[model samples]
Target: MNTKIIKLDINNKMYETITAKQGDTKSRFLLFNLLDGSIPFSLENRSVRVYAVKPDRTEVFNDLIITDAAKGYCILELTTQMLAVAGTVRLELMVIEEDKKLTSNIFYMDVKESINSEKAVVSTNEFTALMNGLAALSEYDIYKSNAKQVPGIKEEVSNLSSQLDNMITLKLLMDIDSTNYRINDFIMVDKITRLQNIYMANFLRNLRNGSPVTIACMGDSMTYGHDVNSEDKRSADTTPCDNGSRHSFTRASITYPESLQKYLNKIYKNNVTVINRGYSGDYVKKGMERWNKKHNANLTIIMYGTNDSRADYVPEEYRGNIDEYLKWYEQAIIREILWGKAVVIFTPPKLQSFGDLDVDTFANGLIQLCKKYNVPYIDTELFTINYNNINSDGVHFNGVGYEIFGMKSASVFVSENLLKPQYVKGGTKLLNRQTVDNFVVNGTYSYSATSGAYTPSELNNTGGSVLNLNPGSSITYSFYCEEDDMFVIPYIYTGADKIKISLDFGLKAPENSIDASIGKGATPLDNNKSSLEFTNSGTLLINKDEVFTNGVECLRIPTKGWHTLTLTNEHSQSTGGTLVINGIEFMNYDVFASYVNINKYYRQNYLKYTSHPILGDTASVSEIRIKPIDYLKLHPFYYLANTEYWRNPPLQLIITDYLKGSIIYTFTIGNNSDTTMFHGEKARLGAYTGGRTVSNITLDNDTREIVITFNSGLTNKSNLLLKLV
Candidate 1:
């Protein structure tokens, strides 16, 4: 078979050509297609390693695949999907035979001269002129080195050139109606003039404030705005900006940051200055480099890490790079601010993984960085499943993708108060500025409770105790304060699990200026009333009663010689108006809870040892802690499940109870999901008496149990033993 490499342009014009016979396919062939005035080609594999002799360096990027339908042979199409790329795309394709061996049929075809339409020819000429003009203006590249010091501005120039290519590509794709075309042309000139005015005004403002705000959108190909639409649905070449340099992937008009500014202006009514510092193929390291340029930003969002692992950057190494950069990033951003303050950071959206393990490592690393640096971060990891919602490429977001992204990141900034709109009316829309419930309190209040409002002092130790007694009892609190501001009372912890307090306040009369009602449990209530009376229907008991606000207000509990008084709310839930106490005078031994094993089950009776419960096996717990205490020490015989056949090993049991609350404990297991069958008896679990032993708890042949002696200097009420068979 004969082989050939053809250089084709958008107008069907050919530049350079290479023709080969069947012998040339033995090795890979490098081809360059001159589209319009730019050279571009496709790489056949997941990644292509390219070595540019001019730069004397080797670089690798994800490859774009193309196929030759005209012939039976498979080809890699490296077409520009967007307008950000210009000039020529250097491509290399390695073809292999069906026998898993190399082929020797390299071919080159020239298709650039085949201009089929007048429009195509005009576009090609225009693109050619633009490319030649750009090449004439700059002779040197500054972004050539990865050295510590600021490299030359070649990288910056390259970045700008890429962006221009992107803009041209978008302009070419846009449907320019004759009338609208002229209108847009006028608008473009106006926009350019407006940009100059805005830049000058911004410069003056920065001069007065002595600090300039720098905003950047950093991410992978998506952040740079890659492919969106294909000219022909069945073209097989779906890449953006396929045959034009002026229309490249990093164009300004289609990029998220560029689009976001327009959105911000519509929303804010005033143009907010934003600098598009986005670059294609940027990862965490690239993000750090951009930040290092000393750009003053009041709010800087970091959008990356999507390609970090895909590009094969190890998590730990990526983490280390990020950690180091964060230190400098924080310091630099703060220094660039009007006052020294850290810039806002946003983690990149999740990437589609061939498997779960891929994205997990990256997600965990991002979380760790955010937590350690105390930087406010967004949760883009959770939004990856609906990734197609915001992304065009499984990795990069499209226009809609960037739209959602901008709205989300902006929401986060607003919620964190990192960004505040000029004016917002009352309602949920305006209320979104706060992430947590701290809007009115200007960094002064400790935020004692979850209810944005503070609790009353009565139940809390803020002043005096309203109800402080023993077990199984309750008390009521009453007051006659005028209702002006919203009243919120939070039940504080008087003791651990020892108390369960219910507080409900009420109005004296319906016509009595205010209407008061009780809520279900700890739900916040808006006590808008005059003379309000709150009643707790049970006697006050230790561990059962809840303390109200701890520090915000002063309480006036019954100072009239504290004689178990019960006030009536006159209206409430669970109301018998009978004050009862349900408190344990002394902590009972039966009540002490302990997590004995890891990845196994233990009977709550004898604390017996076994691979699993005598009856059956439960679930597995991988990484767990019996917090406030350790579990492995309590149960030593427990081992990791079957080394060979490991299913979901029973690691911990998630215990959830409505009244008793919920707790999880790591149990013990001897083998993994290796199917094991048991035929007979189990051990007995009994309490010990004297120094020898006492109770004989027997287990039938079918029953599972383990007997153990409770040796304690303290009294034994009820002991729970997990007997694994």
Candidate 2:
């Protein structure tokens, strides 16, 4: 006989559910998907214990995978291999009552193996409820709080409370004292709690409604609830005996989402489900992905972007990627909200002003974008501001922060406007006109095909036409003609996939005499690699060597599509350049550049950027070039000129400060396990060395870790070398 436990209501009393073998050789597997509720789990009298004897006087075997389920479900598989035919197996889903009475109920199953036939599909509601009942555990919290008031409830509460206390202690050590095992161990603690809450809420709600309900809690780590426990003994191991011991708050009973669920259920006068889908170190990019999983939820709340502003990417670039992320995220939220036009709430990162200008800028930008998208943006930041409260870390919040934030968001769902949309979806009539007002049209160059020929949207200083590539502004050229005629000029354009113009063209067309006339427009500097040649089917190459400050490359393109462009280092020198094109198309290509020349001081104060090193570092600048690989951009850090930053997606590079200059030190980083191609066309690291990928490089004599940092705010495009030693 196999041991099994199930839970089902018997005359409105809590009972541990059990399944018995009914004229069967073996017991089958039982799985349950519980809904959101207050009680952690319901089990009465330890109903899942091993039996000394089975029906027909046979031995019993117990096998179970008893952890919280991934979703709102639990599974129980049993085998009767050790039991005699017609053996009896007994179990029940049970819960303790206020009167200190044990409850038990038999678990039932309807398994009918059949061939193809017109059979009605069985519903999963009843099966899920029974399974949830068996696995129900005590909400040690509720038991502890109320036990003091009730006489004779001490021993039961102590036993249940001790188990939770031990679990809480273990969870605390799992976080701060990572040396005991691995850092990943503590991550599962939150995951388990999330599942427990979802299961408890669903199971209790099922009993209340006489049906099943699904709950989901969606957001980031804050939504996951991070607490530092003071009672955890394990944290002591990480510190020295001489260090004074201190108590910290553990993550055991910290439950913001559960608190919200409880509030909602009480307010609604019925059972409501809640699931925590919060990830530890996730942003909007990750939050959107997790929410896409199939779940039965009439509502969802999205909280994200608290972690994105800290990323190493440039502020402008980060905003660009975030823009695309939000577009997709908004669409997904709309689908969920409109599922019967269900209610949805979008919460922004709470407003806590960081000294960094970039973070504030990014957050404000996101807030504005959310307003335009019509997603309800909850102002979490305002709570802290209004209450004059502060968390010790100056980054995260205290208990007050959680309480205020949770209440404000919950209030949105309670309001009558929960399902109402302020503006209709796809209603962009106002946005388009608003954008046009701020467009500030620079110059419009139309291609009429009247003179020789020109690319669509081509702009130049000739034929009485002019368009300026301002310091931070650009204009698009539209194609109105149908002919495939080509246009030529004295500049080049590089897209995400390939280069439109190469430097070798000027050398090939000697009669064009573009180089001789360079002084008249753009002169060649000593650091600028002016030498030009052709490779790979007349592909052009430009090599910038020993260039420490700034450089520029000019070329002409008469064709379109994708082209291959390469740049290799001649000698270590910090360098990068802006590509100038005469008759090229500019659509989705966005160019961003920045590097710090150690010699340049800003207002006599040293700049501080964690992502990159300051000026006057040992790593000298080397080679830098942009190439097309995919529709996305790929920046490969390199040093050696001959080395190739293969136009493959997902290119990796290792930049280090060695051999004095970036020309001879910088190299590409590759791993044998890296086979997946990147989604973008090319990779461009602004402050980069030439084409040299090395296995290891020594920095500052003591063998340091080599890593390249791309600093976007710097005007010099100088690569920063960080030592991981």
Candidate 3:
């Protein structure tokens, strides 16, 4: 395909205020379209070029990020030398194709001195981060001798170390925007927060199906789009329902909510009503009163704590005060729920700490409330990586900053496919697996491109052997955990049968290496070990019945982080079978309450393990990775069902009763059109906390579930296993 520029954007908006300064550091985006082609057709082609020309046609910022092309755009970082020369310059964006210059768009820039106390802190922080990142890359690069990289690292470290001294110099400098950058004690929060699929997901799904969606934005000034005059040092009025200063800095045309609406309509081809119910000083208690039934909505986005962070209230008994921050916050939340709306709370963007209340406390309180209410929210305070992108007042954001916030907030919907017809329902697509602290075996297995048939060990590289499975073929994994939680192992195995697979902890045992072509349970080289039987149809985990007697068990590892598990396929005599091995996942279970499982009968059919909350879809565990844990945090759950295979509508099962030995949950399998429930001959579960021995698994003649009764050890009562079988 030939090169094409479908669209172009600057700071994700048609208009953005950019400033150039003398002897300062800065960056701008000259991002454009042209995404559907090979790298050589665009990125590698030295495609676009940008220029900043003065009134006299003097070109400034000749240095641009044109040569740099990413997924869709370019990040133009200005040279310190370029920014040092300040002027009101015109920036022209263009595309170069086959020796021709094509104009994209242009904008005016107010190039002035931006090296004030506020900018200094921002610049210093960015510089420090860049330096640290480089240092890390250099230190971790196994082959650092390739280019004087080690020397470069030392020089950069020295330079960044020296820059730290200038932070004190900032205190003596003059002009500044509302300032707060505790570098010394600064905690790095997540730049993007993704959590459990909560209420809006359902509402969003309805919206994409051409159904109407109304989002209520309620909070204080920030939610109302508070904009401070950095130059004049004057604050806007707090009570204006619609004000110029509340929008893209002037005019309520493109405030965050407005921008959000624009974005939704553009993408969904349907109008999504975004009601702006923000007032200047709306704190928690006062905000709760506005949650009237008259203000109904499908989804509500509440961003409070701005006024509460600095509000005056009794301090001594604050924690126990009925009208304290969390008290009113909880009341407001329950109000929204009562109003029949799903809520998404934000950790009101940061502010300079005033006295007793800190943003962390405010933000964390919302998290605690979410758990209490079983709700969902954006963990903004802890996971926003755009600190340097904030507007003048560190507390509030302008359009550019708000634009990023809009996209990030919108990401939850976008990422979850809520803006489209629900296709491929449930489960976060494992497009790419996380290898953080993970192990991978390289170059030891067969691969396929047509089916995207992957091999996990291909990507994981913790200095291990590649996995090549067949009869008597197996590989072992060594992992370390910090806490004792039940975990499940999910794998992608295509077409195989009667291949005895065994799981062991820590110690290595006999090698039963076999070929992929064929082999049934191989002839005993030693003794008969209990193992899960694998078939192309699916796998049957080691039935504990034989496990306790034969000493071979299913794939459930319960131990501390410092542990190991070995998986081996035994040699076979009968025509074993041929199989393709792909990815295998290690995830812990946290949803101990109630959920459905793909019983052994359903295992061989159309479904793999889809993780749930408490054990986030991520490979990133919350507790005990680096060392033993004194504290722990759980993850949000994920939903999974063969949306395609099941012709029926979605099915939900709730726990009806729980006794000491037996607990009962309800479920309805199939599309509801058929009475047949799926059953698997073999199954591998992620986690389980019941009796070591199963006397029997009985399906209710009344409902649809194989009621399992647990007896013995784990008496936590809250440890319900949540993994695919």
Candidate 4:
């Protein structure tokens, strides 16, 4: 049979909930979704194992018989005796699909005991619980005075505990060594500082609710917990290592996966379960089949691409570039999202700069995937840049290094409003491209009104004056860009089948001239291939949804200067049906981590940022200054002329809220000569739902301020926009 687990719930609506009646009497019977499937899966290969933890000292563990299977659900005949336990019942379903094994996240049956005691049960201080565990696990397991472990630990814990509203951190740190610890494994207490899990609202929500949510990890050997040797064990194997003789904690006995489980167990009060589906030595491509059929998670953190630079790793078609790995990644992410899974992609930490495996180039592209797919990701590439010697060789992280990653990831999810209940959907709720802020206004431009040419005309769409292409003329838009970046023009195309336009993009200066030919054949820089002139296409619809999907695309710009994008209706077949346009969008694309690293390199070297910031939303910096460069210490990577990546966003802020109210936003553009303001002169001030989506909105051009009002309360997280027409 071909099938996989969606969730570990029973009856597709409930769990293995039962009751412990008095004496030896049973309570109720229930059906379980044990290896549910369609087409009536063969019972010969399926199995269901259920475990129960009772109120007393008793426990139950047994295999359930699958009586039937149909309609994507299996039936387990739970007898009255099976539901006789009063505590917590755990259910696990296992299925085989195409020779690969699949397991579901544990399903909990909230069993209630029939008896209620009038006497109160003793409660333990959560801190006392933590201290007890630590005392037993450490070498200094005994109390000195019948005294405590250390004055510092107590004083600090008391101080933090006094301030804490709840035991969230202690809950997180307690699970690290309690549940999954082995002989060689021990908790790094000093390493368990309260980290900032700012982007983990969903994880925290599940943790607080005691709801089941899976965190799936995909990667190569490092993620598989490969040690100094025995690097091929795909599962979380810790028994084969001879390296245990080398040190107390070596490859065979340590894993960040286990550490993360411990951390999660603490914060979740042993409520959350981690699915460690790590494959040993598995590249992203090699793990696709397994991930697709078996690994179902609420949040998946992918830590691959570390092996892309290897000789045998890069695929044949993806050679000569670091971005080739993203092609595979892009496909995988889309599949995952389509499967109803939220994903978090992480940029790998800086490596030992092997061969041509350029970290920055690859890292920047990974961020683009997040923007492209509209998913969330962590930029550890930025965090790992400051620390050195965290690796065993050039590839693996040692025990301390793994612990650092464990604590770092937990901190990101649990620290200071990191899981602030809002951004829990991850960056999925974020706009890949902010339209209002990236608009370039050009009312007056040169035009060619020749035979079958195109002209700039305005069409009425959604009660707005929309830009249109008039056949027999061509319009050119000129704009200033600080760095070489990509622009996605927004327009509505409704022609016969598709609308193809010939594009002319180039630098204003003759010295920096572009070919503007069919395939962008001209190149001032002999080596670097700048994807300039091209034929762009969009869907055919005379009147379509006002979106940025179908528009002219200019991939990567080679030069940063005053440039023009002349989109001509060269395919005269569609020249009869001109494509309407709203405006162009600047995908202010940059890896946050890479940007941090590049900037620190400049500051440490005191190198002036001899470039303009590609200002955009989401990745803006707090400060901006333009000054003279100290020639003595110019960081090689700070040269804007040759640098394809940029590190800063202009000093601009747009606070968008989802609630019913009026918000007055104020901004200053020409405040300084150092940075250029977005919206240039084409600032169309309004809340950007549509041309006039929100009825009550006003623009004060003199003050460069906007007032937006709503009839109904807005969502807690909302995006306000402006557009240049």
Candidate 5:
């Protein structure tokens, strides 16, 4: 055998390409002396793996022979399969150690074709056997009779032979241990474990029982099904749409969640509903907020970290450290586990032409956390790095990529036994409750302006039409209210300048108005009284001090009838200022109050958990109460008073408390016609004092109310915090 040696430094680039003849397979060998700067990197007790990408996009994964481990030397004996391609092969060396792994810079291998090379022909034994069997069948009397009746039998037999050949070829290509050059070797799984499959016990049970299962696929744009369809596609330079910006472009039919649903239902023959709760351009922190709002899913698959890899995505304190940066994800996983719902985390693929964040390190950190918490995770880096999967933007995936992802995800669920129930916990009954509804009137809707004209501008962030209000113009919006005491909020976009706002055109007097600029309610402007003025700071500040940054409240509509609210831009014609109105949001006072209360509670108790000396850490005691209006606020999109959009019912609040073995938690509910009601039988009470038990569950049929009380006792230093789901 002919031998060739190549010395390559790990710190510098390799300018020379290793050249070999295409047909010189068995007699050719390449030896590599790996050096770190001026010193030879020790390879003792380490494994060196070679990764090569062939000219036809096929991949080769093989280990190199370590001839001198102490001297950092390895040898790669060229094979007929490796030298079959007569083009440049991109190769890299990965040295794996017990604690760490190091990869060398990518190098090239150019293989020249021989002058008189000829294509090699091969035949399989299976094909020969099948042909012999068919020949033998022709000698039988039954075969002769059938062949006389069917004139196209010969063609059909030929077609069957061709199909068999194709199938065999495909099976050979798919085999990971094939000595021949194969395609799709990059799609192989590196790790497989089912230790954390127990977390999905309840979800699996639901599927087995033929009960409806809701799976929430939550992440950024990838989970939102970006680039899967034509409408949502973007170029390399185009910025990804935010949460509500591209809601209309997202097609639920083609998303990965939908694909997963289709695959699962086809295999399991069960009812599975997958909702895409994906918000584009969102980091983990924002994802946590959105999930906290409403994640009433039996299983939640979270795939984030793509947008978080942007240069400015993470906080300064969280930069560089993967553990600190992924704190939000850790907390989210823990919350889901505590809520008794199954969770599957997906580490996003590395960016091809996008941001420069170290996704590999981040993914490794996530895997470590997943192992530590005993949570299942799907590492999508290897699955999506191919050119056929990623889109032109290099951040999102194409339809094929999404489909493959969905299929593989379904396969994982089946292969890992995640669909089999291990420990069945009784299902918690969801409460039936009525939530607040909201009405919105676009700026281009029926309205009259005095003095200057109202020209329609482009749509705003919420996808509502915007009307640019000319200086010195007063626009009066006449909208009817269904109930009394409904609050009206006018969405306005004001440029930097001091603008006078006059609200004296309504028939009824203004009850109260929040002056967001000053962060307080201005004195009520009586009907035909004075106007209020405030300066536009041009910065959106979301805080308790000023909740409505782009909108001002006109609280308390005295009657449930037709009402007109007017806003007059007091800027002179020559002053040159802009006041753009997007739309008006009219919500019931009680509903608005509830929305504020819920939002406030979320902000106060956000990621707040209770820890005891003996009881350990409990899930967040915060309540997850959100109405349709709240969800819409988080993911705003264009819609009028459509009942389907506005009437999506809110989730029932379920409070959980982890107490000491001897302590008992009592939840009292009054049996009043106008009070809150609950299903006493559905209440889940687990006592750790000795064994799990539901002590007392009382219900009042007349009042339609219920009270749940567990075994009573208390232990010192027991955490009594409660969590509302």
Candidate 6:
């Protein structure tokens, strides 16, 4: 579900409007980021109350659930009565403390009418209690005024009595059976389930597409493969190995991460890199900090309770309670989910000679938290109990034991079909092409011999200033594409010498040569061989005069998600040939537009505050020219001022037109005094858009709108169709 996150400033009185569909009781939610000016308000030890006046002037009050206290994040699940009327509802929040209250300026919620038949509103216990308390207060006020014979007090009591009577009647009318409402109306189970499912689906889809998937094994010494070898045993003061940062005895390939990678590669013909983020003597708190520092993995296998279970391993904040430590672990899991990662929590393996450590309580608490958040978990204690003599030191696993544990850990992913493509109920949508330059910010470059490699240098060619690679040097790029049949075109400046080209699916070791059969399930352009390998037998030879050109259609990607492509200088140092790489481009195959289906799903699942077109239609037109204003129309949510209310702004936007092609635009927006206007900001066109080219962008100060002029004449706006997506 695409949840709408709204950031509101308590000090500012400018009203911001959010929207909800009528009768949306469970799926729609408003996640509010309460702020004091620009800083997040401290929600610690504070209770938040939401008072809303419906379009019909009916009032409803409830306490909000604080998701992240430090970040001042609270969530309110829309109820039936809250969205009953199809008009504006005034809302206000009050953060109450022991001695004072911080009240927010009134905001508005525009509820759009839905087609579903309206049912009788259901009143919650909290609402009933609130009404009862208010009624009692009004009666008390009347008694006080009558006894004192205050002149204006009597009139005030009469008005309060009238309002209290109306409130009581409304409460009685809404006191109906709530069995028809969704279970999610009372809890956040469905929301967590939906988020987990989406993450899992995307992960599985990438895995099936032969994309590079990285997993981080995060835990204590057990995850570090401690005692795997007698000499590899780490002490309490040993430095932690985070994503292979520093080499140590425990950082050997015999670790569980290596075992996991080997097991996964053996089972599935795909590249899976597992990073060991295990620190010796680390507990849940330290693990949370480490993971937060660097969490780029698609899946993180967390097993940190063993160290946390130690008798003396208690933080002051946790107060020596195992349940508090478990809460910390749950927070880490929630962080992973919020970061868009598929998480798997593993109960710490059984300990042998550890004295007076409450491992059982910690593990049990973890299991309960996993269930609450709908996270997948493995009971490692049970699995370890079935094994014989797996532990070397009572605490850490031996080599054989680590291997077995790692192999078993991979079973959950396979059994759950997390590495397999799912049959989603949607039409196939063609995505815009993705491109990567030689100087890709995140690309990794390595050389067998660094003496000949230049650090900061560029080779001027027809394609532009490109990076040059000496003999035995290679560069690897990791990118994400939506379509499986995308073609990869690597532009190279083939010098006078005959430079051999090789295409590898992922980053390859120096000793390992390119294998044409590596991509088992992938489709190659050539009938007899895989597209991932380009040899002299099936190579596209270009003349030296054709300086920088599309060298070859090297590979056809089999699936979508994150993919790694390596371009190596396939020459020995003795040969001494330079490889000039311009860039690489991923092009999509033409197909019918599935924007209609995508839009329908968005409207049903997402809050309709702003209409941001997700995908464009490509029904019949052969060519369509799209301008900046066309893009604005396609992405009104981001182009409009309402996007400032979003907690996280979009980094990239893909717009497709009826021409059966799309352009990916990437841009960054800075703080604007006038939130409605995006002036002097430039968006980079990062993909191929068939025939159309956006030359310049100019903003009209009068209208506070973007006016785009193309190299070609803008005579036919009808022919310049822009996609909603």
| TM-scores of the candidates in the order shown | 0.26, 0.25, 0.30, 0.29, 0.29, 0.34
Question: Which of candidates 1 and 6 is the stronger one according to lDDT?
Answer: 6
Which parts of model 1 have CA positions greater than 4 angstroms off?
A: 1-214, 228-253, 287-292, 312-341, 353-356, 382-390, 415-725
Alpha-carbon error at 43 in model 4, in Å? 42
In every candidate, how many clashes are there?
Answer: 129, 85, 42, 33, 1, 5
lDDT of 4 by residue, 119-155 (tens): 3232211122134332242212232222244344323
Number of the candidate with higher lDDT, 2 or 5: 5
| Candidate 2 vs 5: which has more TM-score | 5
Report the poorest 10 consecutive residues by lDDT, candidate 2: 425-434
Q: Cα lDDT of all candidates, in order?
A: 0.31, 0.33, 0.40, 0.39, 0.49, 0.51
- What local lDDT does model 5 show for residue 146? 65
Stretches of candidate 5 exceeding 4 Å from the true structure: 1-199, 208-210, 228-253, 311-321, 353-357, 385-390, 415-725
Compare candidates 5 and 6 on TM-score and give the better one.
6
Candidate that beats the other on TM-score, 1 or 3, i.e. the better one: 3
Model 3 agreement with the true structure over 1-725: per-residue lDDT tens digits: 01112234422333755654544433322224333321212455544445656533445423223322533343344444335445666666555546776554576666575556244322211122234332343222322233363235333333433343232112211111123322232211110111123455677567646567888888876666666643433344343342223322322223567656765554344547888777655676555544333364788887887667554542434432324787667556645554557777777765533453565566766776666555566654422341344464556666555554554454344323222211211121222222222222211233233323433344445322223455544333323333333333434343345544433322122222222211111111112222455443454333222232232323433333222233444434323543344334443323211111211112221111111234223232111111000000011111112253243222221111123232323232332223343232322233333423222233323222233333332223232332222
TM-score of 4: 0.29
The lowest-lDDT stretch of 10 consecutive residues in candidate 5 is 428-437
In model 2, the Cα lDDT at residue 232 comes to 20
* Cα lDDT of model 2 by residue, 173-268, tens digit: 111221233322322222333443444344434433434344566665566654453222122112211123222323324344665565444333
Winner of 3 and 6 under lDDT: 6
Candidate 5 backbone collisions, by pair: 661-689
- Per-residue CA lDDT of candidate 1, range 322-343, in tens? 4534433333322223122243
